[model samples]
Target: MTTEAETLARTVLSVENLSAWYAESKVLHGISFDVREGELLTLIGRNGAGKTTTLRSIMGIVKKRTGSITFNGDQLIGRRIYEIARKGIGYCPEERAIFSSLSVKENLTLPPVLQSGGMGDEELLEAFPNLRSRASSQGTKLSGGEQQMLAIARILRTGSRFLLLDEPSEGLAPVVVKEIGELILRLKARGFTIILVEQNLRFAKRVADRHVVVENGKVVDILSAAQLDSDMERVQSYLGV
Candidate 1:
């Protein structure tokens, strides 16, 4: 059952006219979007188009950022990174950072105990059965796709309501990609709100409820899944995918 906190959720994550800089270099211009309850939103664009930076800014990892970012009705402009995480936002970067020396179970349990309503290892194992099989293996021993699955699954232990996933389909075999796509859909069906940053149009087309196209550091268009299903050419021209 979806709680009032999840429903009437209006917007779990909202960014308005956001901008960011690394030292003197401006990376993101004024970009804005919203992730509603249980929605699977995605950001797509070319390399260097500021997709990753946008996620980093939302997580408060950027050196400097400006504009209004609100999570669950609280202003996030000046919050620390962990503070933001505590507000129920989990981020998985493109690199899939895992502890190479630790076993899969250990890596999953390493994060600070969360205070919100995300998934646990047992539940995540049910969501990704392959993870259950590899639970005792060292992180380095897993294949690339397994590592990616572990990385995203581990973030669930943080108890986040909103997940920001970066290029989750990158560099995986088609079979692995298909599995990842299914994991994302199952997450959505379970009422987890996700904002995925993807370059793979096929993967995004499968999972996204809505699509936001970013170009030259700004969101240029917003399209529904229905729109994408009806017209791939329009989306492809914006993304060159």
Candidate 2:
């Protein structure tokens, strides 16, 4: 049996010396990491540690950025957001960006399907059973978990196999968080490569294969599930958990 670390899958996303800024303020300072095909990797850090900026930079949402972010041998630098999305990478931002005026079904189907294999509305709704019952309700009518599910489902419709998920478990009830975790695992089972940004280490450990530790916009360490287990105390001390 092949292990998660022993898999021969090629590197799906390679990031090297990545840096980005918000106006005059520089955030990421040459952060670097690589994710393999079908692997679930997490960027774990405290608030304002540039985890979200890293995701934005990958999607070309952070305009003033430098360094190489390659997906399947395609360079992501200088690409437009639409171009990136169309290149088979989906991004689910931390804030559930569902339109308040739109119904749940509307929000789920809003993003254009970027490729041939993108999941349809029916498939996504089926995967997120909570969304099925509330399909006709306005975005504001749903709970936090439902909104998060809607955000993730919206991206799946785009047919981007590589996903950059930002804090999918944030501000949710325990049961809801567990549901989200199960959903992520299901997606992983379907062969989607995922890069997750998370503050919840416990949650991250549950779903992630490996973790890249970020501090002040730089990658300080990378830990596997076993390493993270043995070093839990040290990791938590630095994370301020």
Candidate 3:
């Protein structure tokens, strides 16, 4: 039997009737979901299905949105992006926007205040040993996989509880994709809540416990990983994978 405290602590994020628009062009259409603490939830969709927009809206980056978004029991609506981030939310965009000229260490060192107690290098290094080898290398000097690893590693360093990872598996080799999948599971084991947006079905299945499918900017379906696998046709129909 789970205790009341345990049940209460399990919920980390809640999105209720969330909507977004870019200068009168409405994108997301009243999508909603709940992210339980320590669970890896993946938003599976094709391009322009509002996956990235959802992440941005949660981060308060949309500039114009409606409905309720509560993180860790606090109302996220009307909060600034920095304030949202400070409350343990981290957003990794699809572009892998690392400072081209800044070295790995320098990139991680700047914009240092994300969590209350900063994270130690050992924790992130343990997650990705490859990063430690190229710690001194310039951001633009690293390969695609290395850059992706660094992007995530930088987020971890911020001690964020909820990670909005956008397309971490995009444009990486199979081995690197596997490594990222492992990294997601490891992060989940450490009690971090992750909202991963990915088009890679196999990679998403490997880590996501629950699945949310978006179509035409709305959450059309939600299922467990098993349900998604068993009903591949349904997933493929909406995801068009």
Per-model TM against the reference: 0.92, 0.96, 0.93
Please give, for residues 1-241, the per-residue lDDT of candidate 1 as tens digits: 2335434657877899999998999989999998898899999999899999999999999959999999889999899998888888888988898898899888887876576566766777887788788889998789999999999888888888689999999999999999999989988998889999999998999998888999988999888888888888988898776
Expressed as tens digits, the lDDT of each residue in 107-194 for candidate 3 is 7666566666546777667667887888898987989988888888888778788899999999999998998888888878877889
* Candidate closer to the true structure by TM-score (higher is better), 1 or 2: 2
**Stretches > 4 Å off in candidate 2:** 1-7
Clashing pairs in 3: none
Better of 1 and 2 by lDDT: 2
lDDT of 1 at 167: 97
What's the ranking of the predictions by lDDT, best on top?
A: 2, 1, 3
**lDDT for every model?**
0.88, 0.91, 0.86
What is candidate 1's TM-score against the reference? 0.92
Model 1 steric clash pairs = 118-159
Please give, for residues 150-185, the per-residue lDDT of candidate 2 as tens digits. Answer: 899999998899999999999999999999999999
Candidate number that wins on lDDT, 2 or 3: 2
The runs of at least 3 residues in candidate 1 whose Cα sits more than 4 Å from the true structure, single-residue gaps closed, are 1-9
